[model samples]
Target: MRGQSYVILAIIFVIIVAIFAVINVDPVEVNYLFGTGEAPLILVILFSVLMGGIITAAVGLVKMIHLQREQKSLQAENKQLKETAGENQLIDDDNNQENPDGKKNL
Candidate 1:
């Protein structure tokens, strides 16, 4: 449901940008690091949107990779703890069996 809402919002945003871009079809001066150039307003708006999406996706990918690594580390630690607990339980059982008087060994 959350994903569906995001999709719907994205579609609506695209429609709005498309309408805005179409309304301003005049050429405009864009400043670049090296020099300045002239381009249609529609192309400029679309390019900016595309670049923003790319950067956002890249950041999301990095965060996902970090989370995956953290998850694996936690899983390994949990497995180690479980194995240690099992070993301790076995030792306790052995001690109980050896002491027929039902007295716990200090």
Candidate 2:
């Protein structure tokens, strides 16, 4: 499926990035604004990736909550419409089955 291909592509891309990072060993030093000790290249890379993932997950969670609320509202509205239609139809059926001579004619 199309989704599977996308997932495969993402995996390939991550592997490539990891391989590139490990091979090229960039000399990156991280100096925290709060006087924290400098972090090595690998640690910086991992922390950056972790922060990105956390942000992405947080955004997804917010969207999921919003979607759930919308789905719940739509389901409640559908139930109300179905009940109203059923009540109207039941009234019409009872009228049709009744006899003018006060006898059941169903």
Candidate 3:
């Protein structure tokens, strides 16, 4: 099933991250604009990955919201067009009935 595939992929991802963390255990100095500190290399890598994922998700969310708004606007426009078409059809039917002789009114 699709759900099973996702579960398998998640397990594989966890194993990969675990292997990465175990292989990178050395402490290293981290520098920032205002301060500096020492942290395990694995922690720094994990933090960077987490921040990247957050940023990527934020960007995707913004795009999804924009698309949803556009979809709603399109749906409203479609509904309006359908209503106008229905009104025109009704008027044409009335005109045809009044002109059963099949001649122009003008």
**Candidate order by decreasing lDDT:** 1, 3, 2
**Comparison by lDDT, 2 against 3, better one:** 3
Residues 1-106, candidate 2: write the lDDT tens digits. Answer: 9999989997997787687667755565566787656555766776677799799999999999999999999999999999999999998888678577877755
The candidate 3 region of ten consecutive residues with least summed lDDT is 97-106
Mind giving the per-residue lDDT tens digits that candidate 3 earns over 58-103?
A: 9999999999999999999999999999999988887666455787
**TM-score, each model?**
0.89, 0.72, 0.81
Lowest summed lDDT window (length 10), candidate 2: 20-29
Q: Which parts of model 3 are misplaced by more than 4 Å?
A: 1-11, 98-106
lDDT of 1: 0.94
Best by lDDT: 1
Steric clash pairs (candidate 3): none
lDDT per model, in order? 0.94, 0.81, 0.90
Better of 1 and 3 by TM-score: 1
